[model samples]
Target: MRDCGRTRWWKGAVTIADIKSSIGELYAIEQLARGASAVHRLHPMAKLIATAFYIIAVASYGRYDAGGLMVYAFYPAVMMAVSETPCRFLLRRFLPALPFVLLAGISNVLFDTQTAFFIGPVGVSFGVLSLAVILIKAWLSVTVVLILAATTPMQDLACQLARLRIPAVLVMLVAMTYRYMGILSDEAHAMFTAYTLRAPKQKGIAMAHMGSFTGQLLLRSIGRAERVYAAMKCRGFHGAQRLAPARRAAAADWVFCVCVCLFSVLFRVVNFSYLLGRILV
Candidate 1:
């Protein structure tokens, strides 16, 4: 019985450590943005517009056009390479969002049963093709967004939003909401540490205590937010907070944006997958 208790405690400690590590990794994108690579050096507005345009183009593909969607992967592949972003790291972030995408894809698999193609003996349904397209679109969209986030600071992105005439209140809310995530995580970590210290023998928090624990966490977070807002007010925050001056787009930035928009249109109109097959045949 004593040995069993010790084993449980050990597992609990390891779980807590993993949680702490994940919390740290949450801010890894911010750290990656600080890199001095060419992609990282691009103006935030340029990257933002390019990313949005790329995603829009990707999402505009037909349900069974998986082959054409393959070409869209080029954007993320090249951006990841240029930005020097690690595939495995972005993949880890992507995995969490996979289940939701899978749920949507799987529904198509169950319903749309018309045959779209056949390979030798096997008939592939339109649903299967649609599923593949969904998966591909999800990968491309998530990867490009991750790449943009990794290369450009959130503060810069928010400032660009302001320049784009997003309402000042909306801009401030978005920026503060992002910053608030760090605060919430920090509070959760501190609370977990304190709980573990207080309940050294317990393997986990008791279910009966969960309500009180969560209530306390909420109270603590609210208090922290209040103090933060007070400090902001003292510092002359006027409804909206601008982290940095909006960067004017350089000639290179305009060139980059134009090229991205042009390539997006090119990829949309030209089915490179079919062209590749023709050449191969």
Candidate 2:
């Protein structure tokens, strides 16, 4: 019994450590956005426009165009290199969305198994090709968004949205949600730590207690949000809260945006990967 208790205590400690680490990771992108890299210095709108174009180009590729989509990988790679954003951090962020993507992609494998191509000895199905395309699209799409977040501060993003005349409610929600995510995580961490201390013999909050734990967390978050809203009201926060004005795009910003859009167009229209294979052969 004593050994079992000791094991549970160690497991509880590890749970606490995980909570603390997650709280830190919640703000890791914000920290990266504060860097002085050249990518970070470009106007936010330029980056936003470039990202939009790149996403459109990626989505335009057909299900069997996995070879063409490979060229789009350069955008995220170059952005990460130029912005000096850590690959590990972006990869960690990328993983959570992958399961959902894989679940959707796998359905194609099960349903559309007609042969699309063949190797020297084996046949490759259209389903397999589609799955590859889905994975590539998922990676490219998620990585670009992560790069944008890592390089551009959330406040700047909010301001740009407002400048674009996006509805006030959406703009406020985006800003407030981004700002409050860390606070919510911290609250969860604190609650988790307290639970661990109180139930030292428990490996984690038991399934029986999970409902109560989650309900209590939601209640706490709501109460804290009420207080925060009150404070904001006291400071002149109306129904609409616009962030700082975005700076005008400079010549360099224009050049960067044009270059990114052109690159996306060139890769989308011309199958560079196919061309390279032909040249090699």
Candidate with maximal TM-score: 2
Error of 2 at 17 (Å): 5.6
What TM-score would you give candidate 1 relative to the actual structure? Answer: 0.89
The regions of model 2 sitting more than 4 angstroms off are 1-20
Tens digits of per-residue lDDT, candidate 2, 34-54, equal 999999999999999999899
Q: Model 2 clash pairs? A: none
Alpha-carbon shift of residue 125 in model 1 (angstroms): 1.9
Superposed on all Cα atoms, the candidates' RMSDs to the truth, in angstroms, are 3.3, 3.1
Cand. 1 Cα-lDDT: 0.86
What overall lDDT goes with each candidate model? 0.86, 0.87
